[model samples]
Target: MAKNELHIALVGNPNSGKTSLFNALTGLNQKVGNFPGVTVDKKTGSIRLEENFDAELIDLPGTYSLYPRRADEWVAYKVLMGADADIKPDMVLLVADASNLKRNLLFCSQIIDLKIPVVMALTMTDIAAKKDIQIDINGLEAELGIPVVTVNPRKNKGLTELKKVLAQASRMNQNLHARDFMNTKKLAPESVEGVQKLFPQLSEYAAIHYLINHENFPLSDLDQKAVEQVETVNKFNPNKTQAEEILQRYTRIRQIMQQHVVEHGPLEKKMFTEKLDNILLHRTWGYVILLAVLFLLFQSIFWLAQFPMDGIEWLFTKAGGWLSTTLPQAWWSDLIVNGLVAGLSGILVFVPQIMILFGLITVLEDTGYMARISFLSDKLMRKAGLNGKSVMPMISGFACAVPAIMSARNIENKKERLLTILVTPLMSCSARLPVYTILISLVIDDKYYFGFLSVQGLVMMALYFLGTFMALIVSYVMKFFIKIKEKSFFILELPIYRAPRWKNVGITMVEKAKIFVFDAGKVIIMISLLLWFLSSHGPGNRIEKVEQKYALLAQQHPAQADSLQKPLSAEKLQNSYAGILGKAIEPVIEPLGYDWKIGIALITSFAAREVFVGTMATLYSVEETDDNSSLRQKMDAATHEDGSKVYTLPAALSLMVFYVLAMQCMSTLAVVKRETRSWKWPVFQFIYMTGLAYAMSWLTYVIFS
Candidate 1:
C-alpha cells in the first residue's frame, strides 16, 4: 500500500463483460498468476491514474453474491471482504451487466453495503436496449449512493468517464456515510456486534460474513476461537441470516430499479438469441451441428495450415543446410545445426495448426456456443458419471491439462470432480497435435473426398473422437469403483450469441503460440542437447572402435566408400549411448510396432508429450545423412535393420494411440496430485493410463498390421 498508489478491485458476475473491461483498461500490462496459497488465477495490472498516483487493478474471480459457493467465489469474497492479506483494495470497480439489471444489482448492492468506495460500470446496455429495457445511469447512481457509468468495454466506450468517476470516488470520504442497501444490524445484531468487536475494521456486512465463514477467513487462532465462541453464545443461524439478507437486498433493489429502470412488455416476436437457440439447442440437430462444427474445425486445421507448415519446414531445412556447410565442421557446429535447429524445427513447424485450433476454440467461447456444448453434453456426461460442468474442463483439456484439471474445482460434487480430473487428460491436447499431424501425414494420404473433405483431416478427427470416447468409457467404469455419491444438478446460463471478437481471438492465438514456443521449447531444447551428447558418444570404446573400423574399410575399398557410408554411420549410432538406452527398453515396446528409436522418444517425451517430435528430430539428426532433410522427411525415410519401413501405417497409428491414452506428462500428473491432495491418485493415474496405452497400442498394431 504505497502512500500515493491506489488498489482498485474489479468484481463482477460471471460473463458480465468483466474480462473485456479488464483487458480494455490494462491492455498488454496484465499478468496472470495464481493467488497466494491458491490455484485460482489472480490477474493484476498497473494503470496510470494521475502523474503522481498509480493504481493496481486486481481482477478477482466472478461470483453471483457475497454468499460464496465455489472455490473461485470464495476467492472473490475473501478479497472484497478484506480477508485476503495480499490484496486490499482502496476502492472497488464493480462491473454490472446492464441487461440483467435486477440480478446484477443484487451483487452491486452487496458491495455498496460493504462501506468500500465503489464505482459501477454498466455493461451490455446494447443488449438491454435490444430487449426493450432502459436504465437511467445517473438515477441508479443516486439510488445506490455510488458513481455509475455506462461502458461498452468491447468497443472501449465510456472508459475515460469510468476512470474519471473512479478517481473522483477514490478521493471522496463518503463511503462510511453512504446509505446501506440492507440493514445488516437488524438481521443478526448480536453476531454482528460480536464479530465487529473481534475485528473493528470490518463493516457490518463484512462482519456478517465473518460470522458465516470464519473458518475460511485468515483469522488468528485466538481470533478464530473468539469468533467460534461468539457463534456458540449467540446461536447464529447463517443459513437463515443469509436468506433474510438476500430478501432485504432484493426488496431494496426492486425499489431502486422501479425508480431508475424501465422495461417493455414481452414482444410477440422472439429475441434473436432465443430464435437461434431453438435450432442450436434442438435434441437431434444440436448434436449434428456439434459434429459438423468439430469436423470443419479439424478439417480447417490441415487445409488451412499445410501451406504455412510446409514453408516453415522448408526454411528450417535450408537453415540447417547452410549452417552445416558454412560453419567449420566441428562437434559444436554439428550440435548447433543438427541438434538445436532440428529439434526446434520439429515443434515450430506446427505453430500454424496450434494457433488455428486455439483461435477456433476461442471463437466458440466468445460466441457463446461453448456453453451450449456443456448443455448438450450434460445427458451424455451424466451417463458417464459426470455432469454438464465437466464438459468445460474436458474441452479446456484440449488446450492443456494442467489448467483444465485445476478448473475441475468448480464442480461441487466430489466424485464427479475427481472423475473429471482423472479422465480429462485423455482429451487430445495441443501438445499431441504435432505427433498426430506428423503421423497422419506419414500414414494417411492428403487426398480429398467430394472435393472438400480431407482423408488426413478425417484421421485427425478420429484420433480426437477416440480419446473423448475412451475418456467417457473410463469414467463410466471407474464410477463404480470409487464409491462416493453425491447428488448433482446442472443449471447453466447460456449467454446471448454475439460475433466473435477478432482482436481477442488474435491475442489468444499469439499468446498460446508464445506459450508453446517458450514454455515447451525450453524442455525440448534441453532434451535435444542431452540426446545429442548421448547419441554422439557411447559407453566405453565402442563408438571409437566402430569409427576406426569404418575408416579402415573406406581406405581399403575407396570406390565402395560412398556405398558403405550409410551402414558405417548406422553401425556407429547403434553402439552410441542413446542407442544403448533405447535398446534397453526396445523389447517392451516392440509389440506395439515401436523400435528402439521410438523407444527413446517414449522415454524422453515423459517430460512433455510435444517432446516426442523433438526427440525424433534429435535422434534422426544424430544419424549422419548426406542431405539436409526435415524431420518429416527423415522419419518417412527411416528403416529398420532389415530395411523394413519404420513408420508404417500400423506403427504410426499405434504410436498415435499410445500418446492419446498414456500419462506422458509429468506436469499433468503433478497437477492431479495437487488437486487431489495426494500422490495415490497420480500414481494410479500413471499406472492405469500407461497400462491402457500399452494394451491398446498393442491391439492397434495387431489389428492393423
Candidate 2:
C-alpha cells in the first residue's frame, strides 16, 4: 500500500513461462500461501524496482482467458477483473507465449480491453524461431497500446528491460482512454450500460463480465439481485455474448498479426522434437521407454544418494557419540544425545534421497516428458475411471500426498477429481522413503545383478509400482459406486522437448529438502523427545523398583555387571509407560509379527509416516550401549521375547506393506477435508486405507512367516 510500491499481477496462459519470469525477477524472495477464502495457492514475491522503491508481484494461476472454469482459474479471473479485494493489482504483467501467438493473443487482447495498464512479456521466442516465425515487437506493442518486452526467463534475459518498463508504467498516469481491443459495447450495449450504471468505474468489457459472472463475484445480495434484474430486463445471453466477444477479439487479433507477424513458410521437414517423439511416443516403444526411464530414476535415487546419506548418518552418529562422551553422565545429556540427535539423524539422513527424487522429477517435467507420460497413460487412466489429468497428481504424490491432492483441483470432472484425491495417497511418497529404505536394508540382501542392478533398488521400485497399481485398482472400483456420471475428455498439450533447466531443477531440490527437514523435522524432534521420556520413565515406582533390583543384581555379580546391564535396561524399558501403552496395542498387531515396540511406532507414526524411523531411533537409543551404532544396525539387532530376531523378513515386509497402504498422515486427511469441503471423505479415507493396510500386512506376515 506504499505510495511508491506497485502491486503487479502476473497473468498468463498455462506454459506461458510466467513462473520462470517470476522466478527471474524475484529470485529467492518469494513465499506461497493460499488466497483468501480459497485453498488455491497464491505465490507472491517482492522485487526492488529501484532504490527504496519495490514492487510486490502476485503470480496468478494460469488461465487461457478471463473466463474461469477450475477453482484456480477463477482465482486469476477474479484478481484481474478487480473483484478480488485481497489482490487488486495496480497493473498487470501479462506473459504471452510467442510460439503460439494467435492463441496467446486472445488472452492478451482481453486483458488490454479490461482498461488496466499492462506490460506484456513475450516468451518462447526460441520455439517460435524454430517454426521460422518472426515478430515485430515494436509494431505489436504499438497496435496493442501497451509496452512489450521479450524475456527469456530461463537464461535471465530481457528482465532488466521488463523491470524498467514496469517502473515507468507504474509512474505514468492511468490511461482510461486507450482504444479497446474490440468494440465490447457493441456485443451487448444495453446489458453493458446497465451493468456500468451500477458500477460506474467498470470498462465496457468489465461490465460485460459483471452481466455474466455476477454470481461468482464478491457482490452483496442487493447488488447481485440488481445485476440479475439487469440480466432479466436486457434478456442477456451469457454464452452468446461471450462467443461474440471472442470472435470479435480474434478478428481484431488476426488483423494485428497480419501487419506485425510473419510466418516464413510451412515447415519443410520434421523438427528434432517431432522426430524424437516418434520413438518416445510410439505406442509399442513408448511404454517400454517409460518403464526404462522409471527404472533408471528409481535406481539412481539409491545410487546417487548412498554416499551423501551415509555421510549424514556418520556425522550424526559421531556427533551423538561425542556429545554423550563429552557431557557428564546425566538425564539431560542422554536426552540430547539419544533423543534429539538420534531423532534428527533419522530425519536428515534421508534428505539426500528426497532431493534426488524431486530433482529428477523436475528434470522430467522441464524436459516435457511428463506431459507425454500423461498422454501415453490416458487410455489406462480412463480404464481406471480417471483421465490423463489424474496422472500428474498421482505422479506428484511420490513427493507428498497433500500437495498432490491439491493439484487434483485441475481435473475438470468432479467424480474423477474425487477419485484422484481418494487414491493418490496410495502412491509411495518421499516421507515413506525413510521407512522403506531402512526396512529394505534390514530385510533385503545387498546382492547385485550384472554388477550394477541392486536387489534393494529393485525392491524399492516394486514398492512404488505396488502403490501405483493399487491406486488404479481402487479408482476403478470406486468409480462404479460414486455414480456421478459426467462425460470426461483428456486434452493434453505436449510441449516440445528442450534441455532441462538445471537451475530450476536445483532450486526445486533445495526447496523440497528444506520443506522436508524443517516441516517434518519439527514433528520428529518433538516425538523423539516425548518418546525418549516415555521409554525412559515408567508409571508409579515401577522404574525405581527395576533400578533397585538391577543395582542389587550388579552388586551380587560385580564381575558380571557389564553383561547384566543389558538385561537391566531391557527390564526397565518393558516396565516403562511407553511399554505399557505399546503392550496395550501389541495383541492387535501381534498377528502381523509386530511386538509392543512396533505397535508404539505404528501409533506415533500416524502423525507422519517418516516419524516411524524417529520413533524407532528414540526407542532403541534408550537401551543402546553403543552410541556408534546406526539405526539400521540397532533395528537389525532388535530381539523378540523368545530371543528371536525382531525385524525378520516377514516383519520387515509387513511393515513396508502397511506403510505403503495406510493413510497415516494427519496432514493429508486435513487437506482432503478442506478440499472435499466435508469430513465424510477424509473419514472414509482413513477407515478404508487402514483396513486395507491391516489386511494386506497381515497376509504378507502370514505367508512370509
lDDT of 1 by residue, 1-705 (tens): 234378899999988998888878877777766687665778888776656667889999988998876668888998888888888888889999988989999998888778888888999999999888889887887778778889998888998888777777777763533578778899989999998988898889888888888899877899999999999999999999999998888888889888889987775468899999999999999999987986687677667878898899889978998998899989999999867997788568767877887788779988999889888989989999999889878876776776578668768677899999999999998779878988998889889999999999899889999999999999999999998866776767899998877777886677667656765566566666776787688989998899899899999999998877666666766788867878999988888888998987787676567767766765675443323347678898999888989999999999999999999887678678877879999999999999999999999999998
What TM-score fits each model? 0.87, 0.88
Clashing pairs in 2: none
**TM-score between candidate 2 and the true structure:** 0.88
lDDT of 2 by residue, 1-705 (tens): 333378999999887888788878887777766788776778888988877789999999999999877778889999989889888899999999998899999998888888999989999999899888899998998899899999999998999888888888887885622688888999889999999999999999999999988988889999999999999999999999999888888888899889999976674577788999999999999999987987688678778988998899789878987897899999999899878887888678778877887788889988989889888888999999999888878876886776578768778778999999999999998779879988998889999999999999999989998999999999999999997877776766788888887877877777667766765567667777887888788889999999899889889989988877766776777788877888998989989989898887887676568777766875675443334238788888999889999999999999999999999987678778978889999999999999999999999999998
What local lDDT does model 2 show for residue 220?
A: 93
Give the best candidate by lDDT: 2
* Structural RMSD, model 1: 4.0
